[model samples]
Target: MTLDTWTTRLSRSLLVNGLPREYVCRTTREMADHLEDMRDSEGDDDASRRLGDPDTLAQMLTHGFRRQSLFGRHPFLTFWLSPIPIATFLAHIVYLFTIELIMPVVVRLYGESEVAFVSGSLDATKVVLVLAMHLWLQAIPVLLTMRLYRIIASRAARPWTSIIPAMILFLLYFSMTKFELTWPSGTNPGNYRIDIGTVSGFSSQPVTQGLQALFVALVCILWLYRVAGEQSSERESAVTAIP
Candidate 1:
């Protein structure tokens, strides 16, 4: 192919491989300029030979864009924070509405909490349910964050880095959900009582919510790593299977 044709091919290939349009435009222009400059240094044949074919070059670029270093993964939350994961964010909104529907049933089943719970009030059990549900809502953010990272990480990158967001999200949810306080109730004029407990550690409660969140974060990290690893394996197998 001619130089222009080759550049066009590379540009199209990069676009097809999911690169952003602006990036593709800028990159293709720079590459074309470089090729034009080198056109005189050696014959077109030698230059083409050195640069390789459009298909090969595009594949190499795609590979580089996809791969990320393991250590850089922890602090690489920028992309996760940007672009707004629309699908997953919408899913979380759906989840919010779903909770509105489902929690009433959950409360009705848990205790005589339906009336208070549905009306946007909280007794001890209702409060626990709300907190737990908030924690569950965290799944959306972590799941979306995982997907975003997966797009950038290489197949052989081991998916170990996805653990960071998963763990952080888990701790965030866990800390918010972990509730410790005393509930005062008076059933008779002369008698009063203090009730205390949590959803899990109803007794022997931990004093610090951070400690509980940290433990939960560990669990989240382990689970996320296993899940991401399995998914990466399956994807690789599928790609390999594509003849």
Candidate 2:
């Protein structure tokens, strides 16, 4: 099949699988083409092999997109180039409940007790560094998503109202998983405790946490709805203005 044909089919496939169609067409199609070319090159020596089988080609293309590490010349590129709206509604719902709700609640319930620590300048510096990492981790995904929205739909530029919700959701997830993973593994001296407990919950009470998280999630959903509306309107206006 021709390159355009393959891209169009693959684009449709991704859409059916719940990715945003326009984005897969614009951002990911080129990568698919490139991977196809690489596979063709590799398969050139095998005269009997069909290099462009659609099923195999699609799998390779999707894998490349997922495994792409945007270091070196394209440092930090994945944040923008990720397949947007990549998850199905069911998958997103599952993620929301497990990562955003259940895990955070579990971590907070079991991990918040006080622990003894040594006092020193080194310890203080370690604490600061860990806190900084947590802050950056929380901020990067939201900031990147906003930046991607601007790049993808430039005409619909507006501050993302979804950030508050994503943040709240992340905090819920963060509180549950952070310390349980970061605590020191042994009685090693001069070590800092990267406790998940340090992450303040949305609220101490589970019910209160859920309510606050829901508010943030509502803000996010509304913002996303507005964004989709603005993009659609912009596209319509452009089409009307076309000669």
Candidate 3:
């Protein structure tokens, strides 16, 4: 019932209701000020009497401030399905192509006397870069997918509408997508291949990658559920505190 307690509850509710952080902070500060003024004039510590319940106030504020854009309304279609994954794949291709173009220039920079040294250095560098790129390629999609899921969970009335379909798409991408970088040999410029299907032979790599992706997805889901539970507890306590 205290001003700080009321404002804290209101802030959480506003965020859960999809109001932006800036808007929520501004509103909470303004409301706290108003509550202080009311307390000074009326000599009452109970904020519910001045501003109504925080949950109800948050609902009203959210109605005014929460505006859904095309992306917000259709997060699955805009974020999860097409552009992000496709764009990431294209970016990976572009990155590999750039490395291919640069390797020759790098090799040329060394003198004939340093040919052995240059080749060894280039091979080492290629190995490091390939490993880095592989990790990057795998991590980016998972990070992006989880980020989108978090946004939807925080803002959407029914987050699963976007989350379920997105999860499915991401799992498919994780299982099917593969990248291979071949280091340069004597005459062959280093080459890279991107594949999106089953490997020719039975391999454990896809299964391992799929399990990793599933673990990440599972962790995110559990975390979101915990957050939701905490928010519900806060809301319930706020309601009970109201006279």
Candidate 4:
């Protein structure tokens, strides 16, 4: 393989093996320099042979680094079975409470003003706040959970162990949680509701959330499959490139 292709594969292997980006970049540069020197002394043909395969090199480089941290060494335990889920739930509660406290104060302060500009600005602000809160309450938890799942899956030896449960948890959370923001009418301060369990009603909210969760899960699965395929291809190319 060409030197450029070799280095490119090496960089990807390093990243897949969980080395930090800065470290991978620095190491790739050093390897390229070493290869250049080897070529100068032994010619192009022998240089790559002596330099070793990218996948093997990446394994050796990351072996020590991976053992340095608990998260790196035991990603499934540290991330999947940890307190992160509870913390995320509590954080959402705190977020709702803060919004509840702040919005009423904001309305009381601005709701009484007779100035046309102030009234118009309050209406616009209310609209923006409602939209922002709706999106955040619905999307943030799923996004955050999936993000953690990605990190853990990338580092864990058996990714499916975490991926399935994580997806299930995300779907449940999305379906159960309810968030509503009502705009203030004249002489009345606005109100917001955040619920975390099933409501006794025939509502479409659960169905909508279910569909959204499924779509997000499908997308994440596709992305993981693509990444796995690319990594496998890179390894095959690296192996075949060996003389």
Please report the candidate that would top TM-score against the real structure. Answer: 4
Residue range 79-197, candidate 1, lDDT tens digits: 33432344345445646665678767796787656554454433676566655654454444445555655554433232345445534543454344334433434642121111111
lDDT of each: 0.52, 0.41, 0.59, 0.59
Give me the candidate number with maximum lDDT.
Answer: 4
Candidate 2: C-alpha RMSD to true structure equals: 17.1
On the 0 to 100 scale, the lDDT of residue 22 in model 3 is 57
| Error of model 3, residue 240, in angstroms | 21
lDDT at position 140, candidate 2: 38
Q: After superposition, how far is residue 4 of candidate 1 from its true place, in Å?
A: 30
Candidate 3 residue pairs that clash: none
Itemize residue pairs with steric clashes in candidate 2.
104-176, 179-196
Estimate the TM-score of every prediction. 0.41, 0.29, 0.53, 0.56
After TM-score superposition, the amount by which residue 87's alpha carbon in candidate 1 deviates from its true location, in angstroms, is 12
Tell me how far candidate 1 lies from the true structure as C-alpha RMSD in angstroms: 10.5
Tell me how candidate 2 scores on lDDT: 0.41
Q: Kindly list the per-residue Cα lDDT of model 4 for residues 1-243, writing each as its tens digit.
A: 667778887877776564555667788888878888877877774434777888888887777666766666875665556534653575476467656775566557655432332244335666676556555555555565666665655554223334556556555555555555456788755555555544431174556445545654665566557656865775455434432
Off by over 4 Å in 4: 16-18, 42-45, 83-90, 93-97, 109-135, 144-168, 179-193, 197-243
Ranking by TM-score: 4, 3, 1, 2
Model 1 per-residue lDDT at 142: 49
